[model samples]
Target: MWTIMMILLISLLIALFEVPYLRKNAMKREMLVFFILLVVATGLGIAESLEANIPNPLDWITFVYKPFSDFILGTVE
Candidate 1:
């Protein structure tokens, strides 16, 4: 709870410090991308704090590659 709050507080401070420059300089696309990635990262952090089963990216990669690896090995044998 406290940790999540602190994390949000820190993120808020960072955005407060950085967003104005982006707004003033006409960096709308960069600003949008920044916030989008920030939201994703913050959500993942909160989920991790809650001990949620966040699936690993590597798991998907392994799932996709395992069959290919097995086929290659079978050909080698």
Candidate 2:
């Protein structure tokens, strides 16, 4: 889809501008972090394009906390 293309194109543009700078400065770790973040962003973009059911981290956090919160409220009441 156009969304994927745009995402990739923008990412490519960023690499085009940034990667060489990282290489010029011998920033190996920075380069690795950049690529890792780029790949993660791209994968999330593609998954979103396909409407994959990506689980929300907040939902898990809330699920894990809810019982404890209820217990506290029960004791407080």
Candidate 3:
């Protein structure tokens, strides 16, 4: 899809512009972390563009706590 292509192109452009500087500076660990974050962010962007319902931490928290909240409210009432 065009969105995916655009994402990849942007990522590639960023790497092209940043990687040599990292390499020249010997920032191996920083580069590794940067690439990992970039891949994750790009994947999430693509998934969102595809209308995927990505589960968030808030969803898990609500699922775990909603029942407890209801029970406490019922007892108080």
Give each prediction's root-mean-square deviation over alpha carbons: 1.4, 1.8, 2.9
lDDT of 3 at 37: 91
Model 1 lDDT tens row, 19-62:
98989985789999989988898889889989999999999999
TM-score per model over all chains: 0.87, 0.79, 0.69
lDDT tens per residue, model 2, 1-77:
89889989988998899988889996688889989999998899889998999999999999999999999999999
User: Model 3, which residues run further than 4 Å from truth?
Assistant: 57-77
TM value for model 3? 0.69
Name the top TM-score candidate.
Answer: 1
Q: Give lDDT: candidate 2, residue 42.
A: 86
Q: Which scores higher on TM-score, 2 or 3?
A: 2
Residue 18 lDDT in candidate 3: 87
Tens-digit per-residue lDDT, 1-77, candidate 3: 99989988998899899899888885679999989998998899899889899989898999999999999999999
